[model samples]
Target: MTTITTRTIEYPADALTMIGHLALPADTGRRPAVLIGPEGMGLSDVERRRAEALAELGYVTLAFDLHGGRYLSDPEEMLARCLPLLADPDRMRGIGNAALDVLRAEPRADLDRIAAIGYGTGGAIALELGRDGADLRAIGTVNAVTTGRPGDAARIRCPVWAGVGSEDPIMPPAQREAFTAEMQAAGVDWRLTVYGGALHAFHHPPVDHTVPSGVGYHPQHAQRAWRDIVDLLTECLPVTK
Candidate 1:
């Protein structure tokens, strides 16, 4: 097994003290880093584990918090908080920028080699960061491709990769088409992968709570989606060995 280390880091955003999980490889040199965003439920063990796995790949990684480090397990509560936040790009940017600041402050992070990848609401935040003209090497989102304000996507300077379950009602065919049209009109290099036989949050492991309709887990596609995301990092943000 690869040698890696982890720590809990905290920062401020939106009147809340955000908690972040940082993971690092054992190497002494600076390395590329990935900012991971979790679903609307907020940062959970799944995202933290993703940070560790990314660290194993030799990239410093940070799984950032939403909702001031609160993980909302109730569907109504999660939606109540996330829906408004998702609708506000400025708020999303604030949250993402806060996490970016925390990540950039880490000695192990390579400021020029940063990627943002997120799931669900987290993915929307990542997209907002890119749309706000952040210097991102790549943006990978799973199940969070939503329509943005007019001409906003033009600000994205990096490639965008999105994955979604084919049956995702929250991001159905019309939504996907609109997102693609925006990307195309913006002339951004973008890719969309639709996983068949899956639903929203297909990448997630089985959860113990009820999270509204149109959400499920598909282990096979989840692994495939992760591979696709890793490919995005490898192609756009490779670290020096």
Candidate 2:
């Protein structure tokens, strides 16, 4: 049976309050913990299921919230909520650090075997954690941006995996090329996988196509991306039986 614990973790100094859902195997012993950042829509059911799925792979997964439980399906509403946070680099750092702190505080969490994964804006936050010198074992991002603090990329000290859709208009070929170049210059062990014909937010099953610039779901790529993420975690932070 799967074991899950849901709780609200308040950020120190009013940085940004977040609700976290921790999922694990029912008989979980000490295991690696993954701090998961949700997409721009915030911590939806999809993100929660992602955490539970990771737990089935023998991980203590923590899914963090950036928007404090408020979610939007409309593009305008989502942008209105996300744009300000993106503008403030310090706020993003605080949110990431707070989530990390929450994960570290869990007794079942293997502090040395911690990793992070994020989707979209959350992906960018995960990258920022690595860039800010967090000693993560690995990092994975899906449809994420790498446009945070300047020179932060040079500080990543762990393996990084980035998954993007070739047809994603927000992150086109030029942007991907630039991101790869930045990682190369930083000397980071990195991998980039591009899924052809997939749009943004391919993993989100309930994508609203009625909206302008809406995204469609791709189950195949989503499953493959999840597999790759788990494989990366297993390679970097092996579980000892």
Candidate 3:
């Protein structure tokens, strides 16, 4: 097993102090890094575990906190916090760039070989960063498939890979069409994978609280989606030893 280390970090963002969980691989040298964004529910054990997994695969990773270290279980609370952030690209970018600065500060992180992957609202953040023209090697998102303002996708400078549940109501067919159209129009190398019979947050594991309609845990699809993300990193953002 690869040796992994984790730390809790605090930084300011959007008028609040944001917290992040950083993880590093056993190697003491520089390596590729990934920034992880969580759903509207905020960062939880699931996101932390994902960061650790990436670290084990020899990448420095950070799971960013969206709610100032608070985990929201109520859908209403989550939407309340996320909706506005979604509508405001600058605010989402503020949160993302803050965690990005923290990740970039890590001595072991390869500044030039960076990627961002997120779920739900976190996914939206990833998209915004791309639209804002961050020099990312790759961008992978799940569930949160919102497109940016018209012409904004033209700013993306890297390959993008997105996944969504086929039955997800939040990102139904029309939304997917618009997203893909923007990607294609911008001539970005983008790919989308839709898992059949799955719902929103299909990549998530079961939780104690109830989720909204068209939202449930799909373990098999979850694993598949993770593999796809890993594959994306391997292809577009491989870290050379």
Candidate 4:
């Protein structure tokens, strides 16, 4: 069984306070740690499950909440809150940095093998961390949006894997292609995989409800993405034992 604990870490006055959950293997030791950023809808039950799953794979995982403590299922409300934050890229980087600091301080975490993963807004946050040279071992993002800055790609020092849906309205095929081109031009080691006939939030399995908009859930894609994340972490942050 995995041992999980939830806690809140207060940031400086100008930064947001984060509510996060940490999970570790029941047999505990110094293990690789992953900082997980939540999706646009915030840290819902589905995201928590993902962290627990990573714990099962022998990682000490911390799923950080970007929204503080608020969440909304309505599309308009979700966009209203998430878009402004996304627009201010620096704020996202600050949040990621704060989470990274907290995770690095954990005695049971292998600081040298830290990695990050995120979805939607969270994905963008994870990407910004890597772009800012955060010393991450690896990064994986699902259906993330880029800020379209040119020089940001050159700062990444770790392997990056991005998963996107071909039909994702938020990140269209052209945008994804352009992002990939920029990454390649920067000489960053990166890989991108696009799933056909899928939409945004394809990795959120428990989010199936009639929101203010017409969005639904895709359980199959979500499961597959979760498995991919596990594999990526294992490959990038392998156990030393």
Judged by TM-score relative to the true structure, which candidate is superior, 1 or 2? 1
Q: lDDT of each structure? A: 0.94, 0.81, 0.92, 0.79
Model 1: CA > 4 A from native: none
Q: List pairs with backbone clashes in candidate 2.
A: none
Q: After superposition, how far is residue 1 of candidate 4 from its true place, in Å?
A: 6.7
Candidate 4 off by > 4 Å? 1-14, 145-148, 206-214
| Cα lDDT of model 4 by residue, 137-172, tens digit | 999999884744678889888888888887787889
Residue-by-residue lDDT tens digits, candidate 3, 159-213 = 9999999999999999999999999999999999999999999999988996888
Over the stretch 67-112, how does candidate 1's per-residue lDDT look in tens digits?
8889999999999999999989999999999999989998989999
Off by over 4 Å in 2: 1-15, 208-214
Candidate 3 collision pairs: none
Ranked by lDDT, the better of candidates 2 and 4 is: 2
Residue 46: error of model 2 in Å?
A: 0.7
lDDT of 2 by residue, 136-239 (tens): 99999999856655677888999999999888887888889988988988888999999889888887776543443736678999999889888998899887
**Global lDDT for candidate 1?**
0.94
Q: Rank the candidates by TM-score, best first.
A: 1, 3, 2, 4
Winner by lDDT between candidate 3 and candidate 2 = 3
User: On lDDT, who's better, 1 or 2?
Assistant: 1
Residue 181 shift from truth in candidate 2, angstroms: 1.0
